[model samples]
Target: MLFAHDTEVSLRAAVALVNSASEPETMRTTADLDAFFAEHGYTGRHTGGADELAEVRRLRPRLRTLLTSDRDTAAELVNDLLRDAGALPRLVRHGDVDWHVHAVDDDAPLAERIAVETAMAMIDVIRSDEMSRLDVCSDETCDGVVLDLSRNRSKRFCSPACGNRNAVAAYRARRR
Candidate 1:
């Protein structure tokens, strides 16, 4: 694996969280937030209210910036996030997941946890010189983050939808 299993999961979760804010916000209501959390396998305390949703929404842009930043800029942003959240890393295991770093309390605000976890995971990414794994979607029409986790590092599209669209366009071009 290019990174630890947990790091990759956290990075992909961050990408999903950032992409959730693209266009008309997908995470609009408490129900939407609940669905997002469930989809991302987010655990721990949740108010499932407006305040929590607001905080997460507020964090989306910052996370997006970090994901798309250059190596030095991304490193600075990751450090700032870790410091701002007062992250204290500790090894913990929950659910079907094995031991991994949890840098914030389980009772901390959900946004804070998400930010810190993303930062911690990014530490691995930066240290391993794998920042190339973070990328923007190659689709000309889609502005979304793409985590290139393929073995050959060939993943270029954010989702299968984008990939299929580009594929069809390429096939049509070949016919022409």
Candidate 2:
């Protein structure tokens, strides 16, 4: 794999969280946030309140910026996030997950944990010189973050929807 299992998972989670805000905002309610956290296997304290939701929403743009930034800028952002969160890396095993790094307490604010975890994962991306794996969706109309985890680094679209859309358009163009 290009990165550690936990790192890849965290990176994908970060991308999904960022992409959920690609349009007007898919995560508009607590229910939406809950669903997202459930899907991402986020295990921690969640306020299930407006403030928590708002903080998560605020973090989306920052994560997006990191994905689209140059290596130096992304590195700086990651370091800042880690520093800001006062992350203290600790290896922990929970639920069905194996031992992985948890840089903050489980009871920490959900947004802070998310930021710290994402930043820790980003360190692997930067140190491995694999920042190119983070990209904007190739679809012109979609502003989603694409995490290219393929062995050949060939993934260009953020989701199957965009990949299929582009494929269909290409086929039609060739037939013309």
Candidate 3:
């Protein structure tokens, strides 16, 4: 793996969270947030409600900006997130997961935990000079973030659907 399991998980979660704000907006309600948290295996004090959902949604744009930023700019943004969240990294093991860093309290706000985790993951990305792994979708019609974690780092589009659409278009053009 390019990074630790938790780091990769957090990075992928950040990408999904950012892309959730794309057209057709998938995270529109508390149920959506609940599903998101569950799917990402997020553990903490989740005071689920409309306000919490909105706060999480508000973080999307900031994360998107960070993903698309240059190395230096991304580092600055990561620092800002850590500082604003008052992150204090600590290693802990829970459930089936091994020891991994958690920078915020388990009782911290969901948004703060997400932000801090993403920032902590970005620390791995930046220190490893792997910021190139973060990218925007290559599809012209999509603004989704792409986390290129593949072995060859050949992942271009955000989803298989986007890749399939482009592939089919190219095949049709070739046939014509």
Candidate 4:
């Protein structure tokens, strides 16, 4: 794998979080915010509260900006994330896992943890020249973002189901 297992997980989680912000003008709500974080398995003891939920909602657009940013823009944002929250690079192992870098501080707010973790993962991607692998979906009708990890670097859809569904539709249209 290009990164450690947890790093990969964090990157994908970032993509999912970004896509959740791409909703139309009318449908985003607090419940929608809760559902987005919940689906992504974001766990925090006190993050179940409303203010925390609101912070997650606020982060959505910022994450989305990262998805479409140029390398310079993304680097700036990554730096801001790290600097704003004082991310420290510490190697840590907990819960039976092997040692890995923890950019997050234990006392940091949930959003700060998320920002630092995501920024640290982006640091890895940038150093490896793999930042280009991060992408938004190519489905003309959907704005979902995705992390492309294919061996051939050819992924264009956020989900396989969306890829197949759209492909079949295109095929039928050509046949008709």
**Best candidate, lDDT:** 3
Predicted candidate 4 versus true structure: per-residue lDDT over 19-47, tens digit per residue: 65664432166565566556554444334
RMSD of 4: 2.9
Candidate with top TM-score is: 3
lDDT of 2: 0.91
Q: Residue 76 deviation, candidate 1, in Å?
A: 0.5
- Alpha-carbon TM-score of each model against the true structure: 0.95, 0.96, 0.98, 0.85
* Tens-digit lDDT track of model 3 for 123-166: 99999999899998999999889999999999999988899999
State which candidate, 1 or 3, has the greater TM-score.
3
Q: Which stretches in model 1 have alpha-carbon errors above 4 Å? A: none
What TM-score should be assigned to candidate 1?
Answer: 0.95
lDDT of 1 by residue, 105-138 (tens): 9999999999999999999988888889989999
- Estimate candidate 2's RMSD in Å: 1.1
Q: How accurate locally, in lDDT, is each candidate?
A: 0.91, 0.91, 0.94, 0.74
Candidate 2's residue-wise lDDT over 23-75, tens digit each? 75678999999998898888989888999999999999899998889999999
lDDT of 4: 0.74
Clash-forming residue pairs, model 2: none
Clashes of each: 0, 0, 0, 0
